[model samples]
Target: CSASSGCGTGILANYFDHYTVFNKPVQSGIAVGDFVTLEISSSELFSRAFMLYIFPILALFMGSYMGMRLFPATELWQISFGIFGFISALLLTKYFVK
Candidate 1:
């Protein structure tokens, strides 16, 4: 066994040390999944939602489109990007959310 038993606990612990603040916590409430909605002119809320939720989706779509670029599209790029993004987001959510 490596020093930490190959458990990745050191990396995991470091991840929480850095990211645990970005996610809010809720226990047994309707507000658990609720993100504060933005008023029309509120750029900060919009930016937060885009950064946390929408931008990644859009980027993946763009990645696939850019790969095709008016040619017949292939599944290779989309699949690879999707798998990578899923793994990344899983780690991020685990790290940031208690």
Candidate 2:
């Protein structure tokens, strides 16, 4: 793995040439430009994927449902609430999920 940024005595790794994996624990004697094997559990991966993909959708649906129950006369309000819910979910996930 190649070092992306140096933090204190540790280095952040750039994985798959796209994503940066931070706060990784490194073993002694491993230095910059060295190849390393990273292992992630299936359950952990699934949970991360679910949080990234499913949570926002569920929030949007719930928001739309709330909008329908609160304002049954207007389709515009329902759509607006759904969009608001979607955006709120995205922000929550980005800041709070990790």
Candidate 3:
């Protein structure tokens, strides 16, 4: 092969070698619209699967803060605070990393 032809072939070979890594797939999961539509479409769904998924998180914070104030010296109080702190950090990382 000519000098230019050899270089062109080398570049093509490099591209093919890395194609699997370089062509990684999209990482999208469930969309927010589906959540919204589910809640809108069925009252049972809003109470059952949707609320079940959502409420533990809401309860975690609500119960944690109230427990923090109510039982300041308890070991369980410390655990609640730790969980609250951990969730906050995870949420912050997710928000800022994007």
lDDT of each: 0.57, 0.80, 0.56
Between 1 and 3, whose lDDT is larger? Answer: 1
Candidate 2 global Cα RMSD: 8.8
Top-scoring candidate (lDDT): 2
Error of 1 at 38 (Å): 16
TM-score (C-alpha) between model 1 and the true structure: 0.36
How many pairs of residues collide in each model? 0, 0, 0
Tens-place lDDT per residue, model 1, 9-88, is: 55555555444344444445546567654234678656655565665676566655654554446777666666566556
Question: Worst ten-residue run, lDDT, model 2?
Answer: 8-17
In candidate 3, what are the lDDT values of residues 5-98, reduced to their tens digit? 5696556565554332233343468563443221235776565543444545665676677777878888698567657755765565455432
Worst 10 residues of 3 by lDDT: 32-41
Query: Once model 3 is optimally superposed onto the true structure by TM-score, how far is the C-alpha of residue 42 displaced, in angstroms?
Result: 0.9
When sorted by TM-score, best at the front, the candidate numbers are: 2, 1, 3
lDDT of 3 at 91: 66
Candidate 3, residue 72: Cα displacement in angstroms equals 3.8
Task: List clashing residue pairs in candidate 3.
Answer: none
Model 2, residue 61: displacement in angstroms?
1.0
Error of 2 at 10 (Å): 29
